[model samples]
Each structure stands twice: as C-alpha cells, then as structure tokens.
Target: MCLIHFQYGEHPIFQLIVVANRDEIYDRPAEPAHFWEDEPEILAGRDLLEMGTWLGISKNGRFAALTNFRDPSLPKRPRSRGEIVRNFLKESVHPSEFIDELAKMKDCYGGFNVIVGDQNRLMHYNNIFDEKNEIFPGVHSVSNHTLNTPWPKVVKGKKRMVEYLKNNPGQVDIDELFEIVMDREIAPDEELPDTGVGLEMERNLSPAFIQLPHYGTRCSTVLLIDRVGNVTFVERTFNSGHFKFEKSFRFKIQK
Candidate 1:
C-alpha cells in the first residue's frame, strides 16, 4: 500500500479502521482481492509476478501492509518487499517477534515500512531507518517515506479521515472513505517532499490518489475491525487507468 490512514483504539465502536491505496504500474499483473484457494484464511490481492501481496488479513485476526521507502540512491535489493506482508500473514507469530526478525534481515530487502497486527496489538517497523515502533491508540499514517512524516497528502488525508470518523462516529461509511482515498488534489509546490524524484514526478505523485500514464493507483482498500472482532474488507480495483471491479468480504475473527 502506497498511502494509508488508520485509527486504532480511538473510536468507540471500532478497534481499527484503515483506508489505503495501492499504487503500481498499470500493466503489472495482479489479481483482485480474494481469499486464497490454498490458504482460505488469508484474504488479499496477489501480485501475480511475485506471488505476494502488498496488504492482507488472516482469519485469525492477523493484518499486515507494506510500503516502499522512496530513495533513489540505494541499490535495489534482491528480495521482493511484497513478501514482507505475505510472510507475516502466513505465519502465526506475534507482531513483536515478527518485527524483530524483520529487523535482523533488513538489508535483504529494499527500503520499506511495514505494519503488522492482530486483534490485540499493532506494530510498525521500518527497514530503511532500522527502527521498530509500537502503535498506540490514536491516528497514524505511512506513505513512501517514514510514518507520519507530515507530507502534504498525509496531513490532509489524516485530517479528513479524522473528520469523517468523528462525523460518523460508530459506523464505517465505505463511500465516504473511498472519497477520502480518491482525492487527486496536488499539493502546493512548496509543500511537496523532495524525495530525489524530479519536481515533475514529485508533483505527479503528490495527491492522495495518483494517476500517471503507466503507473498509478491500482487499488484502494478499506479495512474495518470492530470491538467484537468482526472484520469488513473492501477493495476497489482499476485497470488501465480505469475502474474495473470491486470486491468485499466480511468475516468474524476467531478468538
């Protein structure tokens, strides 16, 4: 996932609420979100080329999402970062242990920021900075850089999400959440982060929702988990820059 806005243990009814967009090249082959046939417990969209995923959740209440850290100077790692989320969901390990292991192998993969959790707790880990953080009850976000780095879209989107949740306190409105993820407004030039990507490319990727000729947001997903351990996952997919299909599923976490 390229952009993510999530609240944990903040709202009265919801334990965790997430709104995220996954960006990639339009031609990259990927299957829409679904429960894997081999592992019915896992629900996520698969990256066909790598046989991994950017985000996924398991029936046991395990959740994971990954984002790449933008840095042009670093050499690409041999391993695919998507496996970070895939391995987390496939295993039954605690988030803390999983993060510890990831930290040890940080140099094996490209720069990345990852979030892993279950019904009980959430953990954030980044390989680029070699740090591990515990997620407390509150609002947080992570994009191409560090988590909550105050990028324009991250700030605006977090505020919008807070307002949305406040207005609709106990309920999760899929449409409104989608609206927040679909925002395409570009940030002012001064507010854009210089990630080594040129000014033109930086502007292109500034919005909460991104659209480029060949590379853009491929899917948007909203994950909601209530106090009772029920989960609602929804994913809207796009084709060659056009809306293609949407898939949603609901399941109660086995306690």
Candidate 2:
C-alpha cells in the first residue's frame, strides 16, 4: 500500500482503523483479497509476480502492511518488499523480534516502510530511516515516505479520518472509511513533496487516489479491528483505473 492513514487505538469502540490505497503498475498480476489455499488461516491479496502481499492479517491477530520507499534512483535489489509483509503474517514472531531478523538483511531489498502487530500493539520499521518504533495511539499516516511525514495526502487523509470518527460516534461505517481514501483531489504544486520522482511524476501520485498510464492505485483497502477483537477487511480493486471487483471479509480474532 502506498498511502496509509489510520487511527490506531484511539477510537472509543475500535482499536485500530486503517484506510489505505495500494498503488502499483496496472499490468502486475494480482489476486483479490482471499484466504490462501496454502495458508488458509491468513487472509490477504496476493501479488502474483512475487507471490507475496502488501497487506494481510492472520487468524491469531497478526497484521502487517508495507509501502515502498519512493526512491527511483536506488540500485535494483534482489528482494521483493512484498515478502516483508507476507513473511510477517505467516510467522508468529513478535514484531519487535522480527525487526532483529530484518535488520540483518535489510540491504537485500529496496527501501520500505512496514507496520506489523495485532490490534493491541504495533511497530513501525523502515530501512530508509533504519528505525523501529512502538506505535502509540492516535491518528497517524504513512505514504511512500517515513511514518507520519505529513505529505499532502497523508495529512489530509488523517484529518478526514479523525473527522469521520469524531462525527460518527459508537459506529464504524465501512463505506465511509472507504470513501475517505477515495479522495481523487490532487495536491497543488506547492503542496507536493519532492521524492526525487520529479514534479510531473510527483503530481501524478499526489492524490489519495492515483491514476497514471501504467502506474496507478490498484486497490483501496479498509481494515477495522474493534475493541471486542472483531475484525473487518474490505478491498476494492480496479482494472486499468476503473472499478473491477471488491472483496469483504469479517471474522473475530482467533486469539
């Protein structure tokens, strides 16, 4: 997922609320969100090219999502960052412990930012900043940059999420959450963050929703974990920048 805006452990009824968009090359083959035949306990979309995932959750409450660090000039790496999330979801290791493992081979992959844990606890790790952090409750975000870097979409999405939660108390509207991330408004030139992708390319990716000739948002996902440990995951996928099919799954934490 490229842009992730969330309220983690700050809602009255929900422990974690996430709205994100997965941006990628439209031609990359991928399966919509589903339980894997091999790993039925795990639920997530599959990246067919790498056989990994950008975001996923396990029956035992393990959760993970990843965003590539937006640096096009870096040397090509031998590893696919999708495995970062897929590996975490498949294993039972604590996020803190996984950091120790990732630190050893971080250079093998391109720069990436990942958050992993359950509803009650979480950690953020990025090879670019090369830092690990325990996530505190409240509104936060991450795009192609570090966590909470205040990119236009990140800041805007966070604000909208906070507003949505505040306005609708005691309820989590899945559709509204999805709508928040559907914002197609592009960031003004001055408000854009320079990620070395140049002004034109930056502008193309500035919106919370993005559509380019080849590279654009492939799916928008909203994951909600409530105080009672109920989990909801929804994925809306697009075909060549148009709506394709959507998948929604709801289940209680197996913990």
- Cα error, residue 206 of model 1, in Å, equals 0.2
- Give candidate 1 misplaced runs (Cα > 4 Å): none
Candidate 2 has a TM-score of: 0.98
> Estimated TM-score per prediction?
0.98, 0.98
Query: Any idea what lDDT model 1 has?
Result: 0.91
Candidate 2: residue 139 Cα off by (Å):
1.0
**Model 2 misplacement above 4 A:** none
Clash count of each predicted structure? 0, 0
Residue 121 local lDDT, model 2 = 90
Error of 1 at 71 (Å): 0.9
Candidate 1 lDDT, tens digit per residue, 37-61? 9878889999999888999999989
Query: In angstroms, how far off is 183's CA in candidate 2?
Result: 1.1
